[model samples]
Target chain A: MTELYQKQRAMRAMRKAAMQRGVIAVLDVGTTKISCLILRFDGVNLNDEGEGVGSISGHSGFSVIGSATTASRGVGFGEVLSMRESERAIRTALQSAQKLANIRVDHVIACFSGGKPRSYGLAGETTVQNQVVAEQDIARVLSACDVPDYGDGREVLHAQPVNFALDDRSGLADPRGQLGERISTDVHMLTVDEKVIRDLAHCVKRCDLELAGVASSSYASAVSSLVEDEQELGAACIDIGGGSTGVSVFLKKHMIYCDSVRLGGEHITRDVSMGLQVPIASAERIKTINGGLLATGMDDRDMIEVLGETGDWEHDRRLVSRTELIGIMRPRVEEILEEVRSHLDAAGFEHLPSQQIVLTGGSSLIPGLDGLASRILGQQVRLGRPLRIHRLPQAYSGPTCSSIVGLSLFAAHPQDEWWDFEMQSDGYPTRSLKRAVRWFKENW
Target chain B: MSQINPDRYTRSDPAPSLWSYRLLRLMLSPYLRRMVFYGIPALFLVGVGVINITNEQRREQVLTTYSEMKTFVTERPEFTVNLMSLKGASDSVMQDIREVVPIDFPISKFDLDLDQMRQIILGLGPVKDVDVRVRSSGVLQVDVVERLPAFLWRRDDGLEVLDATGIYVRTVTSRLQYSNLPLIAGEGADTQVAQAKQIFVAAKPLKERLRGLVFIGERRWDVVLDKGQRLMLPEEDPVLALERVIAMDQAEDLLTRSVKAVDFRLQNRPTLQLRSGAMEAFREIKLMQLGQIK
Candidate 1:
């Protein structure tokens, strides 16, 4: 745990250095595509009046100077499968983005949606020694949290203090300088397979980029797609990607739980290829053109020509009714949504005040997905596109590029994680020095 | 009867090779790009020039070419000084000036050292001041101001004409050469030529008898009249003393007497030395009156 804390602290320091350089690249290494967006931080906060996470929803502090996307290779379920091929793919996307921005970017904040994340809600309590809650008391209470044994071979991705409670009062956002006998904190810790992080880091390093920070694609998409009120009132962002459908639940503007199912649009594309006897590329084209969740009587007459490159003319020219294509695609999408519903139910998402579900990512672009997701998830389901950022191109404004856009926002305004705070001093020498300083400060 | 096409399954590579991507990134770096685009080319040109001019012979050749180009611009018809035009000088003085300057015509104006030439020409005796410049149409204009001769000083070596400020204009063999000029002779007489001229002016009535005014003792003047007679005047107001002598000559015919010299070195006292014959005659007449030798 200390080793991971030190490593995360090093990455946070690198992120600060990248922010000082004013140019950082956000990379979304998805299963279907690798998108890179270079953000140039102008250091001008538009709405910096009130302190706790000022409105980065407007994305005013940074601007997207360059954006490029390439088809992903050697990446499955948002995890790098082959270092060489994924390195090449990352190089392609970053090189094009650097060429467009006419500047070289060294630091990258990357996101992936694989690794099977598990969320643990950790609660810790400590008696206030000084009767007034201080930063050290907060740190002490946070350190008092009993970390669960999230099993071996898994690394904590995000450990954030979601809420603070003072004595009998719970849900206190900040308990500093308040009268309380006891202070406690509720921390949300998400862990993932350590091998996935190492592979992604190695891939980015192979592309000659420093991995400044890494985030889960589900959390990143939730940051961009979910509205502020929904995030405050408990909403779930379902990022239906190519190889995975990422589901993240946000409450009080913080993500409490996030998980991803290993089923996405690529599975539906494979299903279409097998059911209709067509190539994967043609099936992908056909799925995008004629894919719908709710089939109508008119969809039966809407025939889509599925093209093939076979030498036989008859085999190249094949037509499939839209109803038949929908028939091939809807079940897999429903399965992905149903998997997301089970994960939300396990997370106790039904107990939240607002069960608003936002469906986003590349696979969410299919027509009638929201209507079907509403039936399965809740009635408050809506198709979500990424929030508009400055200088984002028209082609990347669709629901397909939500994770990349959200990664840009995450790079601009990262949430405070556990490593961001000062650790509680367990050594006696520093504790005595701190006590002396506190005594001197109080007396003089 | 469908045959699968193998090419449909394969995808072309879109990534650049590692070295090429690194090279592109290095080229995109602003510092390296500026160095390759501007710095290296400029440094190369300067280095080539330095190497080409490193040899002594090549350096001399370059200097000669630069001078030749400079001369080509300056030696145009509008810039060439072909002739010299002299003003305010007599023919002899102008000839002397021409010989002293010694400038070859049809030369570039840039090659003309006018200040040195002017200093050389000023060394001539008659030239008091000179102005030399190149005017339009390539004419070198020399304006000479010659000194005017005022007095003739009879030095021991020869007679030389002096300007009014006692500067020697030229020398002559005979006094008749500048007869219209007054003659002053003494060791330091030339420094007081103005006082000598004033004394000569007061003796204008005795011009027929006045030979010249000699500066005696360099402080007083001695007006020399005909028949070897002289009038000694005071140093402070020698002209006024000479005027008193002229008044005495007009009122009492004192100059016509047999006196050899009149001394007015003292202001209130006038003394005269008579000739020897007049002295002997006056003494015998005094003896007859006393009847000592009758």
Candidate 2:
């Protein structure tokens, strides 16, 4: 509907205004924790120099001056179940970060991994005008693509042209100046539940801050965790969060597919709590201290004390072998991994040239996670940590801060989207569908 | 997929369909979202205002009141430049600068172009740099740095005062005004003021006898004495050569001798051209010494 398009345009305008102001706050509204980062841009334009086409102003430089995190409340499965509690938590994080930065932020770009994200690869093509493609021609081709219904309750979050081909020259990142008879593009579109987005916007409004932009938490995590080579060659970044595990596939520096599994580190902790009848806090401590995927004979002799807060002397002091604790934690972690693998299979991720898997997030911190993921997922797997940021504290340079750091990166240098250009033509649904089907048929 | 709006898809003609599609797509595109959000509401508000303002009497009243408020704020006395002051310049140079960049006072500070005024002031002959600022005391302050005369050069154009960097500052109509400064002359002597200043500093011992310096070929310096003697100095490390010559003069009173010139172009074995009479006497003495040895 035109309403969805209008909302996206409005968000883009807000993002532009915020960027022009040279300072913006990036908020990561995760299930377990909410983080806020304030970035100051140095007003350097990337495209000012002669470089590859993606050198937009976002690729300009920025530095994080303030960052704060708070325990998230009224959030489950990355979705805001209680608006009041989530708003309070977001305010606390933003205020503390603002204090550290010594500047009040009025605009914030938020990222979240909730509302069940769905990815679709849409393709578009147009006959070259004057035997060469202009910016308008590319825009026209993008707008020509069919807007999938994507169900009634879902809304498009990201619609970006991933690849462009001109005549026989395929895999063209940008083809505006090239001479070709026909120009075709493959675009990646991700949609999520509309209600969650509305809730987040409303919450941000209530906090007296403007929602400048929004992104998928999984996509952000992937951008921060995946190495540059892995992204170019093809790789999947599976961000295992506290309440949800995010799976995003990147190829040629573009995310072609993304999905989230409703299970994460919290679920494993819950399983430990239920299996051992220990307190949730104690289970978390035990998980952090003695959690591992592969156990050995030495673990059997190593005992971890699970302190109970029930206030009863009998139940408060109990020691369990590390192997037994690992026994309780492995199945849930395996289940989450199994679900992630199934999503990858459903996405047909094996078709990409590279099958490197990067496992990151707070949950992925479990000792021996990469080994277990590689064994189960059947690909080269590595533990991912957020890339080091300038002046970022050493405490936050871990897998847990991947989403927030990635969100900062996204805010500083956003990938070019479809609406960034002026299209030559307007609205149709069937043209994109036919083009996508043709592309799929030809490629498959 | 179930169609929520099938009527929009029923149009088959490419012309009308494309136009409508383009319009809808443009409106829906996120890039224009803010414009639509604001434009729709603003358009509605403007429409309502236009309908209400259809009465000519009310429109005239609003315009009259707006103009009155604009004039009231712009005419405030505090915003006017009441006084202009110049800083860091001699009174005569300041007066000359004022004549070059004259402005009528009692004007609004906002109406003044500070950068343009600064540029004009810098164009003055003696002004090296200028800074223009408006103080809270309703004064437009101009700070100027006048070029200092480093050396007086006699060029084909006439006598002129040169700054330390060899930039022409002013024409010296009379030499008595700058009698204390060193005098230099050549085709390109103005640009070599720094080197001339160094030579003058090194030749302080013979300052009384020193007349001036002639820059030859824009390279070597010929130190002219008041007694009509010239000391030709080498191009490289002329300071060291001048120091050595000064030391020899202190010990042997070399400048008082009948030597006409000393060539130190070669690092070693300096050659001195003596007066003709002195040269003949030196040759006769050398012949007498040869005859005694025989």
Candidate 3:
């Protein structure tokens, strides 16, 4: 069927709306923080090949007009822990962000951290009704795929036909009029717990905002941060948040797979808290200020002051070496990376051309995190910062803000997805959402 | 000194039936007549085909082979030389590549030699055509054509060159030649090369003056600076970029001279860059490009 069409149109409409309205908002709902950003869309910057839009005012079309973040409550492991508190957090972040942008938003595409995300490279084939594989025929073959019922209480987050094979030609992006007896499709589908998605959707609803769409935080982070080459060949994005670490894999510029580890910066904080006998907040401060994976001979002599709960302990806390902190924290950080590596392996990440890795999130700021990650993840690793857009606030431009900035860019221009689709059902079918989107406009 | 004799026209009279007459003429032209009149090679070809391939089954066999040849490209896999990696030229990057590719190659199975594959796939992400050869001294040699970069991706790590295929063939240590290359930024860049390639390949008209491209959301692309001026284009199609480029040149004097940058990530309008103030100075000099900003 023509499923790819609706997705394409929805994405086109969202992008068009952002361009026309000139302002867009991105909302990131994580287990630790609810961040919001308002961006002003600029011009249609055209490249020589006439792909991708250009900048606004001769600058990148996106700029952070306003930003606001609230401490996330009633959240654990990246999913809503309690509906009421999550709603309050959502309202608080949005209200402040709207005040800064000086506008109101009726719809919000929320990015969450929960869900046991799984990926499948499904394929389908059909002998073309005639020798030529028309779009309809492609759709038919895609629909013909015996896509298993992903089970109950689950939603298909992303269903995309990544590659197409027409007759003897493999890897064909579009095979509409190609003469072929058999056409095959490689579709990547990602699904998550229905209850988690439903809760997030309900939370948005409770906030009186329409759920335009939903994306995995790691997936969105990967979109805003990864470079073209990294994405094409293959790359993994590790988003270490307060309560969870999100992992997303990209190949062919699409998030072929996504998953989240129920551990993140929170674990580090806990390790510091239990080790040093400090409050959660104080542990966070120390972790950020004196964090390192490698502590050498020089560290033992480096003393740090640990403030305590006894209101009058001023200097009573003994100084601890940086090496001591690393000794405590390394195991946790290493655990997270190992978990991510397993996730990537399960996604078949090794098959891609390039195996570069990007590390993002607020907690990735530890001094030697990139080095540690590269050593552990078995790839070229670098800490990721959000791509520069117009009017981005200097305060929010670091790796700490990759998710919110990414979410904003995502809202203004949502990706091609399944809901934005139209099933041709002309006894014809397509698996890719973009084609399904396009199929709707022209056929549906 | 060479002359044609009138005796060459000796076969003008008829044979018997149309088939027998034609057969006799064919037979006589080379063997019976042309042997005494014209040549032998042409006669041999016609006799072989007429005698051997005239049957329906034989004719079908020949047609089938031709059709098969059209599809499979059955020439020996042509030892395609990729030339993407080099042995010692920038060993760090070369070493980095080893992390992603298998250290011990399956050369035997692919009918490729390690030395040959090393030369073929090395330094070749952007290269279009490449050839591998053995030197007289037994050194493996390679000839390559690298992919032309349409944009300069300025990332958190460093600047790298990406071709239409979005392969980061080499890092751009020098921006002197391509100071205004389009840029592709963001995370997961290696995975999005296909998207970048689509955009790069689509930016054909602006190729001569293209500086670099920037990738924002891994889903779409943004045109960074072009001709030193800024132009904004949409993610859908750079038709707006094309129109703005045309409009600026036709009306606003866009790219008429030097440009600052262009924004085309929007829907309708394009922001023309004019170096009028500190803000632009702030915008133009990225921290990564600070070293080269003389």
On TM-score, the candidate that comes out on top is: 1
TM-score for each of the candidates: 0.67, 0.58, 0.53
Backbone clashes, candidate 3: 139
Q: Compose the digit string of candidate 1's lDDT tens values, residues A1-444.
A: 789889999998787778777889999999999999999999645354223444322233889999899999999998889889999999999999999999988899999999999999999999998999877888798889999999999999999889999999998876778899999899999999999999999988877889999999999999999989999999999999999989999999999999999999999999999898888998898888778879999999998887777556777788889999888888888889889999999999999999999999989989998889888998999989999988999888888888888888888877778887667767699889999999999999
- Write down the lDDT of every candidate, Cα atoms only: 0.89, 0.84, 0.68
**Ranking of models by DockQ:** 1, 2, 3
lDDT of 3 by residue, A290-381 (tens): 88888889989887777655444543365778888989899999999999888888877788788888999888988888888988887589
Name the regions of candidate 2 deviating beyond 4 angstroms.
Answer: A46-52, A425-444, B1-294
Model 3: CAPRI class: incorrect
Among these predictions, the greatest lDDT belongs to: 1
Candidate 1 — which residues are off by over 4 angstroms?
A44-60, A430-444, B1-9, B52-54, B63-294
**Winner of 1 and 3 under TM-score:** 1
Worst 10 residues of 2 chain B by lDDT: B9-18
Runs in model 3 deviating more than 4 A are A1-22, A42-62, A311-316, A419-421, A426-444, B1-294
Which 10 consecutive residues of model 2 chain A have the lowest summed lDDT? Answer: A49-58
Better candidate by DockQ, 1 or 3: 1
